[model samples]
Target: MINYKSTLIPALLIIVAIACNRPKAAPAKGNAVWDSVLQNVQTAPVKEEDASECIKLNGQIQANEDHQAKVYALASGKIKSVNVALGDKVQKNQTLAVLQSMEIAASSNDLVLAESNVAMTKKNLETTKDLYEGNLATSRDYTSAQVDYNKALSELNRAKQVQAITGGRNAVYELKAPLSGYVIERNISGNSQVRQDNSNPLFTVADLSNVWVIANVYESDISRIHNGDAVSVTTLANPNTPLDGKIDKIYNVLDPATRTMKVRISMPNPNNTLMPDMFVTVKVNAQPASSMLTIPSQAIVLDNSKNFVVVKDAKGLHKKEITVIKRVDPKAYIQGLSAGEQVVTNSQVFIYQALSE
Candidate 1:
């Protein structure tokens, strides 16, 4: 203890050096540090929107059945030639295929026989009329000749009508399109045998000017959807381009295996962008049950099984707890936030964490 003052001086010098070198503690929340962070954050006002819940459902693009035509072979024959292919655009009454059929050949033969019989009967009638005029033939003979000629003429006309109905020329049946459309299916090929009674269509042509979006709604969501409900559709091929339409039909029946009902949305496809069988996503903007408060979904932060929104006031930014009613893209229906209040949408999580800490 003789040199206590001298030793204390050295110890105080070492303590001062250590204190000067120590790192500074972080700035407190709601201070200058947070002010800088808030400058970069983005905010939006809470607004009230109609509480129309969006029901997302899977769908498939289909040809409009109302505008589709199924082409069938007129008679049993071997396909002589296929004039069109699958996905070929055709006009109404355009020849699709040629079939060489025995039925048509038989009709051609019957027509020839009718024509020959008519010529012979006409000659006979002329001869009988001359003989009757010269008093060499009886009136009954003239009448009989006239009657036979008339019968032959009737038979010839019937043969011609049958040929027209059969749609055959020169013993070849020509399959013609009933409507103007793109061929969506082709079941017959060159040299393939077709039966007169075959139930399947030779080709399926559909007008793609309009299309149907068939969406499947689960049983639980059926009550929320109805006919004439507005909807938007997106496809994997062109997701950025959304087509809008209304639900024109709702199938009252449900698929037992899927336990879902189908709703039909009719949309105009002016560009033919929507193709049949293409999978799509459907968003039905169902009728609003009521009105509710909404905010940008990004403003809401989830933490510890609770939702919070960073609300800015005259004082500073504060994390306020909220109850999320539902979350649709870009907007979230929330409670505990009033309309006109500004909430941070960008970098909200970082600010929330800083305030919580």
Candidate 2:
């Protein structure tokens, strides 16, 4: 009763100690001022996308066979001059090489002999006709002259046809391009001997305006890929820029040696950027069997072997555990997230850690 001031002071001190030991309250929901970390966080809405699996396979760039031409010598000859080199662009019917052929020379001689015989027979026929009209020649003689003149004319026409078929002009044969394209192969040079029986082509011209991407798929993947499936192709020369295409052909036959089936994708090469035999990577977007929710790959946070995404809503920021079905670059197909929901993408790990704590 006598020391009232001292008793009150001790009691107040005890109360202040208990308050210091108690836990601090969490910041209010959606209060940016209280949660300074929210100021730097970025968010994106979850999207619903068709679920798909990507099948990566090795591929090659090939010139379209439809627009390619293999030039072969029609006759045996010595190549006098080659007007084109490998990689040179040429036009249709452009002279590629000049060949001096012995066969052509023989044909020319035959043509000359035929023309001379025709001239001689025509003169004889005229004389015989005149004689018959004057009763100095028999009717059989006139008929024989007409037959001889007709035979000579036939021989002359045959000679001309032989020369035309041999492509012989002035005893020389000119090798010309069958189509307008770049000469991709040149096997003959000036003074080289060529034979009609040669199996190898003398020159190969290809139109680079359209090309094909031939990709190989494993045996296990054959059932997954189909015609009309979308694909992305990238070459070593241009890896960053991917070219879009579709699987236009599926070679049903499998390679016995490789145990893989081949698929073909057609692409337009307007600038001639795609070259023949260029190695490439092909990514086939296989058709989806169902739909799933998608989010930015960066939004995912891995902790304790579990994936989580920090979701932001009107109530507050919260960490929700999610299951990842697949991950394509820049996108992660997932479960446990709804479309149109916002999730933190940037600085999400920090936000997730804070939310977990």
Top TM-score hit:
1
TM-score of each: 0.83, 0.77
Encode model 1's per-residue lDDT on 1-357: one tens digit a residue.
234344433433443344356643323455533445545557999999898979999999999999999988777899999999899999999999999999999988999999999999999999999999999999999999999999999999999998988788666999999999999999998988999999999999999999999999999999999888889899999899888889999999999999999999988998899999999999999988688999988898999999999898766677899999999998999999899999998767666655564
Candidate 1: worst 10 consecutive residues by lDDT? 7-16
What stretches of model 2 exceed 4 Å from their correct place?
1-34, 52-54, 121-155, 285-288, 302-306, 314-318, 349-357
Model 2 clash pairs?
none
What lDDT does candidate 1 reach at residue 140?
100
lDDT (tens digit, per residue) of candidate 2 on 136-211: 9999999999999999999999999998777786669988888999998889978889998999999999999999
What are the lDDT scores of the predictions, listed in order? 0.86, 0.86
Regions of model 1 farther than 4 Å from truth:
1-30, 121-154
